[model samples]
Each structure stands twice: as structure tokens, then as C-alpha cells.
Target: MLAAKRMFSLAVADTDLFLEMPSSTQALYFHLGLRADDDGFVSSPKKIAKICGCGEDDLKILASKHFILPFESGVVVITHWLLNNNRIKSDRYKQTLYIAEKSMLEVENGVYMFTGSRMYPERNQNGDITEPQIRLDKSREEKNRVNNNGRKTSRFTPPTVEEVQEYCSERGNAVDAQSFVDFYISKDWYIGKNKMKDWKAAVRTWEKNQRQKNKKSKDDEGLEGWLNA
Candidate 1:
């Protein structure tokens, strides 16, 4: 079943080196795509499906098993472990093939092309600026986006120093406090020259403010309720 061709045919078996291995769909993911080689993830289902010669529904159902992540626009990310380790169930793959022809609908041809140019999308692009034959350099602002009901939002709020420390500290947690602090700093919560001092001070200040607020809340809740009780 795993018969690779000299040239890509947009058929599922074409790119899959292990095509004959049980469920051919899993083998499809294993070979052609499924790597952190490029943008850290694959983003085109059409390309993946065409390479697999399967329908989109088949892909989605197979994907839902935690093997693939279908993101906004046409982003389809196959988890590293999914392709290398996990195996796809043949029954599910058969079920998917019986469904609608869900093309990734992104690739214009067997080759992935830029939106307005003949150039193919690749892992790297480096050339003299003057050599750019960009017919339409339609650009997008780079920001970590949050998907809200299928719409991308570009707003992000960073955690303050005190917030970070409190997260590291809890009410008598099992992990050692100092170890937790070290782990937190290692995670980039603390950085630069005067980081340790600044982080400690921030924690103290936040705790002081929190105590004052709680005290005030208690005072307000006391009088009327205290008398009634």
C-alpha cells in the first residue's frame, strides 16, 4: 500500500512511504508532513489531504483523536508525537473516506503557492530586497492572537512580577517554595540584572495590598452580621 511516486500526485499514497502499513491515512501523516521542520507546524489540510488522496471529513474525524490540530483559516498542525508515535485506527480512516470530499481547499495545485504569486511557500525565504517580485505584498501584523468565536483578537495582558511570585507560592504547597521560585525564574518570569530583588519586592507589595483589602472586607462584613449571629 505504501507506494511512493517519483513525483507527487496529490494522492494519499504518493507521499506516504509506509503506505501499505495498516491504516494508510496514518502513514500519510507520518511521511509527507508532520514535522516541526518549517513554521513549527503544518497549516494546510488541503495539501495534506491531496497528498493523502482522502476527503476532509475523513481527515477531521481522524484529527479529532488528538492527532492533529485544525486552526483558523487553513491551519492544520499535526502534533509531533502524533505522527512519530501514535497510530491511527483503520476503522476511523475507513469511516472518513466514506464522508464528503473535504478538500484542504488551500493549495492551488499539488504545489503550494503564495496568495498572488507563482512562488511556492517554503520554510525559508532570503534574498536581496530589490529582487522581490512580490506582486502583492499583502502583509499581516505579527502578534499572539486569541481566537474568540472564530475571530482573532490581538490583545494580550502580561503578568506583573507580584502575580508571578504568588503563583509560585501557595498556601503550604507540597513543592518547596525556594525550588518553586527557582523554577519560576527559569521559566523567564524573572530576568535581567536586578531581577531577584525586584521580584521579591513585588511579591511583598502585592501581599501587603492583598492583606489590606481582605482586612477591610472583613471589617465591613463583621458589624451587622456579627451582631445578628
Candidate 2:
């Protein structure tokens, strides 16, 4: 999709041509009988005459004299030839901007930039802008969110004896040296805060259980501890 476009080139400047044209002819060019785009062009001569307060005959007379480019066919070749010449100088003759699809396959000044799919704006060869870039970027972000389902959100999942055994076997009994750092930071332990915090938490539970043991409420000491006792 083309969001915007701008054609830039210096207007034809030659005092000889200027002198050849009458003031009315020059005024017609100033008002302009046509508007150009990257792929096409347009002009409403009727509206133009009405807006400029120019008589319909005056517009025809001026258009004939100045060779004002119209939306009609063959203008592209005419424009190309004129731009190649050194005599004309409008700033719009040399370059144009076309905001199009991000997915638009483009060759600009002989370089490719945008690639992949388009939506919203209709395709037109005459545009310099593309909207496909936005579409693909949004699509990727949506895909990532969808792919992350079933992923855990818990800060820790208690380490298992099996995991500890696997790690020791992988190390062949030689300490990895960074094992402690990994255990502390990685999901391998799900460990957080300090060892002191774990100890404090354990002590609180142990003391509560001891009170239950003293109370002796029918095996409340815990099955393993009571069975041992």
C-alpha cells in the first residue's frame, strides 16, 4: 500500500522559453493542468478552468502552448525523454517517493529491500510505498505468543533426586566448578533468595511439627517419625 508519494525535480527553467510564452501561458503552467504520480497521472481541465477562473478556451490555448503533460497514454516515455534532457529543471523530474507494502518485491535505484506478503493497500506499480513490513512483523509476534503455551510460570519446580543423579553422572564425579552458580541461577534448582532463607523456613516447619509431636494427637508426629519412635 502506498501511504504517500512525492515527485521531486526542478521545474523547467530557461529564460528563452519563458520569453517565448505569453503571461497567460506562463500562468497556466503556474496553475498546472495536471498532477503526476509514480505510476500514473491525472488532470480535470474543467475543474482547473473553474478554479483558476480560466475560460475553457483559455485552458485549451494554454495546454496547447505549454505541452502540459496529461494522464493520457505515451506520457511516460515523453517524461523520460524530457528528464534525460538538460534543458528542463523541475525538481519533480528526477526522483519520487512511494510508501508501499512491506511485502512488495521492489528494485529501487537497483537495490532490493522489502520482501514478503501484503494487505490493506491495493497493489499498484506506480507507488513507492509498501505495507507488508508491518504485516509480517505483527504475524511473528503473534506466532511467538501462540507457541509459548504450556510453558511454566512458577519461579521454581523442586529439583528431583533423578536430576541430581543425572548431573553427577554427566560430570563423571568431577565437579563442574560453576555448578553452584548454575544451581543458584538456573531452573535446575529453582532456588531463590539465600540458603539462610531455606533454613529459616525449614526450622519454622520443624518447630511446628515438634509441637504436634509433643501434643501426641494420634499419629500427628508424622507417620515416619512416629513409626520410628
Candidate 3:
């Protein structure tokens, strides 16, 4: 049986990471947490959002901000669910029915992270529907380094355009592979003043910056429209 009462952590709800989101999105998150099962999985977020006077954009914001992990079956799991409620009684705690989705996730620092490759739909900049692509889990890659002599070495390997393309494709983001390779090649693969340790992380950062830029552009367009009106 599911627990009747739920808990929230001030560490999560008080931080800028949670506070920076729009009020509606924050409200949606709380509602989701309240309605979630003991395993922190919500099988019907859309219905909950609708009932709470929230919209699809609120859910999208939560997903984009990494506050929730969405599955293809329309289920979502709170990313910091374990962090919020870590001491539930074993008898009342029930496992999530989304075992497949749960298997894809691993906990790190009390947060759920996707560690498996799964295909998900994402729209391009042109607002066109594209083929679903696998999500990349960079943490699953080998971290140990070795040289030709099989000795451990701390060397950075610059990724090729094809490699970047594969990663970007898997991430289902609009990060141009050729441009990324070209920019990093010009910089000698150094991020600012330091040599890059992980190219996959850099690619993810670029994707994040691109998303912020796009959101800012949209906000500017809205401002301009309002001013003209």
C-alpha cells in the first residue's frame, strides 16, 4: 500500500535550483510529489497537472530542468525523491511498477540518474518532429585510462566529429557536431584555461547553454510582441 503522507526536504525546495523555476512549475512538482507512489513514480503526471490547473509547459520545464525523469510510457520519477524521503518504513514502502525504467536509473548522492540508453522523442529547432533517438549516459563510459603499453596515463583524447555526432544524436539535442568539433579543435580541446577531461561533459554543457539561449530568445520575442501590442 502507498504511504498516506509524504515529505519534502528544505534542502531541495529552498535552493536556487528549485526556487528559480516558475511558480506554476514549482506547484506542479509539489503536486506530483504528493500524488506519487512510495517509490516516487507517478504514472499519470499529465492528468495530475491538468487537475491542478498546470499545463504541459510546466511538465516540460520540470523535465528540462532535470527535476524529473520521463519515460516513454508517460511515467515520470522524481529525480530527488529519495533525497526527500529517505527513512520510510519498509512495510509501507512499495516498489515502483516501472521496473524497466527503474533499472535504467541509478542513485548518486541520493538522486536518480539515467544510466541506460533509451530512445525518446525530442523536437528540433525548426519545430519539426524527428525520429526518436537514444539518450546518452556518459557516466557509463570507462573512466580508467591506459596507454599503448597498458600503463595508466592521464591523457585527454579529443573526440572526432562522428563521435560528437553519435553522442549528440543519442542525446536528441540540436548540438551541431561539426561546429563542436571545430570549436574545440581551435581551442586545442581546452575548456577555458584547463585541458578538457571529458568531451561528453563538454557536449552536455554546450547543449545546456543552447537551451538557455533559445529560452532567452523566446522570452525576448515575447517581450517585443508585448511592447508592440
- Top lDDT prediction, candidate number: 3
Model 3: how far residue 102 lies from native, Å: 0.9
Candidate 2 regions with alpha-carbon error over 4 angstroms: 1-11, 69-229
lDDT of 1: 0.39
Worst 10 residues of 3 by lDDT: 127-136
The residue-by-residue lDDT of candidate 2 on 112-166, one tens digit each, is 2223322222223644222211123334323322235766332222222234344
Decreasing TM-score order of the candidates: 3, 1, 2
What lDDT does model 3 reach? 0.76
**Where is model 2 poorest over a 10-residue stretch in terms of lDDT?**
72-81
Measure candidate 2: CA RMSD.
29.7
Q: Rate the local accuracy (lDDT) of all candidates.
A: 0.39, 0.35, 0.76
Give lDDT for model 2: 0.35
Task: Please give the lDDT score at residue 48 for candidate 3.
Answer: 98
lDDT by residue for model 1 over 42-126, one digit each (tens)? 4456576676676554454334332343443445544332213223346422222211122422222233222333322122133
Question: What is the lDDT ranking, best to worst?
Answer: 3, 1, 2
Say which prediction, candidate 1 or candidate 3, comes out ahead on lDDT.
Answer: 3
TM-score of 3: 0.54
Give the per-residue lDDT of model 3 (tens digit) for 97-134: 88998887877656776664333434456543233233
